[model samples]
Target chain A: MSFDIALWLVQDGVTNGAIYALLALAMLLVFAVTRVIFVPQGEFISYAALSLALLQAGRLPGVVYVLVGGGLVAAALDIALALREKAPARLPRIVALYVLVPCVMAALAWWAAPRSVGLPLQVLIVLGLVVPLGPILYRVAYQPLASASVLVLFIISMAAHYALTGLGLVFFGGEGLRSEAFSDARFKLAVLDITAQSLWVVGASFVLMFALRLFFEKTFYGKALRATAVNRIGARLVGIPAELSGSLSFLLAAFIGAVSGILISPITTIYYDTGFLIGLKGFVGAIVGGMGSYPLAVAGSIGIGLLEAFSSFWASAFKETIVFTIIIPVLLWRSLRSRHIEDEEE
Target chain B: MKHRLFTALALAGSMAAGSAYAEITIGVSLGSTGPGASLGIHYKNAYQLMPKTLGGEPVKYIIIDDASDPTNAAKNARKLVSEDKVDALMGSNGVPSAIQMAQVAAEAKTPMMVLTPAILSPAVAHWSFIVPQTTELMMGAIAEQMKAKGIKTVGYIGFSDTWGDLVLKATEFHAQAAGYKVVTNERYARADTSVTGQVLKIIAANPDAVIVGGSGTGGALPHVALVEKGYKKPIYHNHGTVNAEFIKVGGKAVEGAVAVTGPLIVPEELAANFPTKAMSLDFTRRYEASFGAGSRNGFAGYAYDGYLLLNAAVPEALKKAKPGTPEFREALRGALENVKNLVGTHGVYNMSAANHNGLDERARVPVQVQNGTWKLMK
Candidate 1:
């Protein structure tokens, strides 16, 4: 309507879009490196937010238990396989990462939860409790099905999403939680008032994105991950261990998800199942990018956020439908532009 | 081995006594683990605090979790009626799920005490009696307050579900009589994280005040957005939004937010002469004691009132036939239709052939969020 109102809407859209962009990048990274859709990526966001909320309240978060449980399961699976293959050397690494790390994190949470640790420590502890869940989930649910078709992997991803959502409910309870804002600063930009929390979201998102770019460009492990994404078997033949690439990608995705959760929790109320819809919106942005290009996916996610903001203003009731509908035309255009190719597995 | 034999003997003795005096079973289906779990869990908790007997008869409550899905609620209702042979049914915190249970109750000719206010079809209405106050009755309190404050226009934002539609219709219905215009009718999904776009549109219209039609923690989103955007006008909420979780989620932004909810939430603020004041106080004391302080909610009160309604009608139904019989169910339905001046935690219910939710203006009280708690607005 008014110029000032339009400007406010744009600010809101961009702030939300920033978070979605982070999620899109994670989805893209996981999908490329592992051939898994990573449907449970949003669960990590909810887990982190709820975990942080609990930490702030000086209560031990249920995510500590999930981390430990997932880690033990992964360790057991790894041990069973190692023994079967007579690869006893692999046992120590599995024990360290799967058994020791989660146990240490859980111990840290148990000790610090009741001390009313300051917000910074709480956030660090939350990151410690939630980040490892990514690799654990990859090892437990995805690695075994590494060579499975995309459809099968997608199905497994959905199952993981449901399982995590249920566990979130059991852990977080039914009430939605909103954490304290990172900052209380508010400034007027023209006629629009900008919240410091939004600035934090946008700033942090860009930093993570730039950091990801740097990592992919400058690091040897990043190059290996890139090679695996380009061709898993070829990278394996060239001595890039597929499992290492998969786990590394998942670790990065989990870190991004946790950071996004911490940034956005102050701006909006997040329930146990809230991440699924947010993740789906990110998937929409990924689809718009043809699920391949990083820069396009970021642009597409920001566009989605802007579109959602405007659509809600125009037709609030049909906002979600309007947002999800964009994927159809984008899919059509991509299908028309790209040449047909044989199935990769075939 | 000796303990097992003694337990078997005690069970056999109780089974013999059970054959002599039939047990009254009430099947309850609630959304204890899904989107509506926040409210449903409270309803479930109320059952734990309820009396063990109904109208001098030993009663059994079979509680089932429907996961907040309407289809599952209907299935639970059917199973309870057929397999458990429940004489009557009670359920469900969400309106959609409650309506599904009402359908099964109507089909099976079993009397049901729905925990949520639902606008049932005439056939379903015959078998289902609503426990909570109707939307019209609850929203009318807001309209009265608006008119008294001389507010001329209001913006509306609510969930895009049956509850939202009902609240909007009620707001509009009262707007005509209250002499105010409703400028907007925006809706958001229950699981939505933000309402910035909707709040911006409402701000552009810039009504004198705003009313949110959402329930549970979801209701806090629009109110928080409105406050963050510097809308200083008062924000009103329906009965559904008046809970500790709403205040907890909305935080300081909802400091001046107002809502009309059951008098059960603020029992101490009710006048001593109020009909349900004593019952409300007692229920609040026991509820908070069991669930911990500041956990008092209106949803749980609805469940307790449902039990009260059934407690009052079961005696009359028992005079006609034995428990676990279809004839007894018909009698219970008949008795429920004639219940009068029965006091419960929320209000004194007076069910009739036409009005199932028999609450009046006395059932609601205006409350404002002050210092992060709901205080009665005198």
Candidate 2:
């Protein structure tokens, strides 16, 4: 309680919290658009990281090479996914998801072999691709499957996430993969004794989140997305192209997921199963913010990050058990209070 | 008729050419994935790269995927032993993993080279002989050394899994015996992001020092966090804690952290006259050439020695056995006592049935990270 572990907490937490927040946003966005809570967002994150790592380590070009690779891979995955949903409307959303996620990953693994793009940047590139990749799959592959069933979409995402984990085991050979962003670039801030990498991660994460919020709030498409989320049928009647809005939501979520992976790469080693942990916590953040509140989700993530920091600072041993237990009461209190307010209004 | 016969003869010649070289089949069950798989890779490379054809005899290895699960290890070991009918077994790396596999080996009466640190215990020789240093024994040395240094307190961290649990208990046991106060600083999943909070609590305790048992990018965050927070007490790290990759991730913050790694990274003066020293060096060189990397971790050292130990015993047992006699078990048991001063990447291993782990204080070269590299301790 006494120690100002906040400096350590903030530096470490923000970088990590940013990653989880973005990944969680992808999960929430997909749910908001298609009404499916995908479990496999982390799988895409793992693939992006591994592919980038292989690319950086070998004969592949610099960041540009990795970026082009990420783009081509995402686009091709999107196209291939688009083709697979021949009867996107006729077949269940689950069916379309099953067909597309594995195919994209298979392609990723093939490219990653015989090259390594150094681990950290690779994770960022992979995450970058994941954001774009989600939209591509939704727009192309499920063209006919629009607004079918949120439940089915959620199931599809879950399968994709699980599939991504298995693929990670196959490709990365089961060891922790990490990147060194600080040394990769170096500029000193006077008297701070920190590297360009740490500064970039911090600055970049805050900037990215701000940009995403702007994109969501300021743009016309952003309004359409909000309309679609709030009242899909009403928005459709008003000529909002709710279908397009849904796809855009998936895209926006993907961007957050990408940022999450990219920003956190320097702090933690990216593992195949890493997503499930981050994904679960991030979704919790989303929930704590009230399922529909964007600002709440962002705030919740930061709060969770702080709580984790404090827990670590105090209960260092068995803190996970304690924090998770505490979460139950926190969640219950929020739920009871929300219900009480609604009761009074009624 | 001549043309017909020549063509027929040519066809027969071609078929003969295809059949001339006999195919050799062997098993290669290991941790193909997971935290410790990296070590399995290096060890497998060394064993596989060994001149399989000594005096024109052929050898073949087919890796059975164990997945690091105990039951899976047993199944895969049995599968390799019976279905694949592998001539030899090498590459299982955990005590539980190896022992589970050993049940199958013992039942099959097949000789298997045990590689995992858990298998290096005294109890392991009952089923399979171990060539690596027992992790428990290594911790013993580490604790004794720490105690001798008048280190009154220690910060303890572990991965919180079965393997990590064992190490923590072992470390606590040994450290306590030497009269060192060990505080439980942190235990989190291998994928956890921030350990600063845990690191902060440890720092606040103002213990004489901290000891981190987990190694990897995930495990390293605590070490890196401590360094960033300016915690400068002697940081005693577990084996496998310091590697080129670890330094790359943690950066200069982990510089001067203490660890007891395998002897391979140590300056080559400890085993001046061991017979296996030259051969082990060649093996290490060949491994680096094959994998395009080098690790000073005990995983490589133990795995390589484990295989050589297995191979050394195999011939002696085979020589005493009746040709085609299913007496490979008895022969192997006898060969265990004779393993002596075999130089391995980590240390000189002189395994006896009573002491399957040949590593001693001399075998363990204590080192610390200096300027992003592992520098040997004086």
Candidate 3:
């Protein structure tokens, strides 16, 4: 390939890599705090994109229904717990999470969905509809089995992926939807024309990454979440509510997923099940980063993106095979380099 | 035990008599709830618009969701044949599932109509009738269009499936015969989100035109990527993308794309003397009347043609045998094979013992996506 084409490929890879990096960061955060693989993280991305598509098409998105249903179920579970513990003091919070938030969102969606809404408002509505789904999903599916083994959680995560995929089909139908680009402006950068959407994706990803770093390092809730991730039992003993940390982490993952979905939707036609593969790519990035280090995950994601882009240029047919095969060598090197530790009994 | 055996025999006799006298049933197995749902839903809507009866007898349709799975299609076909005792069968939004349904129909001695275009051998053709134009038939139109445009070199990007393989092979054969060299061939999964790398490679090859061989909305991915990358070459798509869903998903990116499609895609706009024009307009009217304005799709037209083919043959078959028997089904299959000069929505089908599709250049047309509408090429 020519130098200019090579430079373009790198740019394309980095743009995709930025989305993967966000997904990877979300995966790490969810896994660290909740010990769940967050398989349905990609579903959130699809839902967000589809919701936006529906809004643009002048149709009310089904996300409002899902949010209300999920919130109701989660709230019911919380209510049952609160009544069981005789902790009526938590009833208002439970109601707020379950009844009030979903109702308000649903009401806002019902009102705003019919009128002519701008892109910015539509995007925010999509994000609002999708972000709460993460914690609600955790509460409905994972929180009950919070103390279960990682293997069990993994299986449940897979089940959740299937459920969410089916729900996506119900919500968005089978056809893929593509939204209008955030910006159509193309800047001529010497030999390549860089799209404004690419710049938006890269810019948003970096901003979100830095913002996440600041949140984790500076905020009190972030420190509590960090404590919970460091040692769940110790965090509980030290009065850090592990459950709150779990929900907070999922909320962060949801935000990342929703943002990634909105950013990438314009670049590609996203189907109901598109998020699963994209999320898997992010998971691969997380695995490459050893699931702990943020910088390494970001680097690994860029490597993966570049490899996929270059491999497609070389052998478009086997590009997926090549991208997936990268996991093997990285896994081997990590295993060879790392020391084995015995399992700890909680 | 003897009394129970007698009761069972009596029950079996009654059931046999009951089915033999019931309304003629056409079992349809389609990918109504999966990846194929987008096209399948249109097929379903078209079938719904079909007449309720043929030859003064009630017709029943047993629609089964194949979920875009070949196994499910086969199983559904079997169930429709054995349990439902359907006189005929129709399916399936894809080639693989259609092939499966054809296998079952052959074994059961029932006539089966496939929605998607497929290569039908004499053996499969005996029991199966394809509604859509075959790849070779459509490729001739695409090649003719390219030749007229003075296209010398073409790049190919298609789905990594049987449909893609068929389109690519046909394009290679026809485009080369027309003196156009296929400079590059790239394959991607139907569910792929991006085709940038494939587009880049094709652009690097610097072909005069690019042919994307994918169906439904998936076909739009490569072309969109090409447009986004500022590739100014003409884009061509196969007959598989002759649907509204593709145009809706593709948006402005595919505005100037030329595609091979069946004549029924723009039936009303054809010349007044066109053979299938009136029939196509009729189907379009009924379809649009029910589905709202501009809801008529070429995929649905294929299903409507299937119904017309069956409508013309069922009366002839009814003369030889009753509607709910194996002999009736066999006669129906034979009558369908003999159907000639019958105008349907898509084309004037001329089914013969040798040719199941029964379409010539009359069925194939070149259409350009002009101003977000399918404009028939002169």
Clash counts for the predictions, in order: 0, 32, 0
For candidate 3, write residues A1-346 as lDDT tens digits: 8898798889989998999999999999888888898899999889988888888888888888889999999999999999999999999999998889988887877778878688999898888889999899889898899888888898999999888888888778777888888888999989988999999999999999999999999999989988888888999999987678888999999999999999998888888888988898998988888878999999989888888788888899898898888889988998899887543357
Compute the lDDT of residue B284 as modeled in candidate 1: 97
Q: What TM-score against the true fold does each predicted structure earn?
A: 0.97, 0.77, 0.93
Superposition error at A147 for model 1 (Å): 1.6
Q: Over the stretch A104-135, how does candidate 2's per-residue lDDT look in tens digits?
A: 54445346535554565455446544555655
Which window of 10 residues has the lowest lDDT sum in candidate 3 chain A?
A337-346
RMSD of each: 1.7, 7.0, 4.7
Comparing to the true complex, what docking class would candidate 3 get?
medium
Provide fnat values for all models in the order shown: 0.66, 0.70, 0.56
CAPRI-style docking class of model 1 based on DockQ: medium
- For model 3, residues B166-276, the per-residue Cα lDDT tens digits are 999899889667889998989887666567788889998989999999887888999888988889989999988866767888998899899988777798779999888
Which lDDT value does model 1 have at B20? 80
lDDT of 2 at B56: 35
Instruction: For candidate 3, list the clashing residue pairs, or say none.
Output: none
- Which candidate wins on DockQ? 1
What DockQ does candidate 2 have relative to the true complex?
A: 0.45
DockQ of each: 0.74, 0.45, 0.57
The pairs that clash in candidate 1 are none
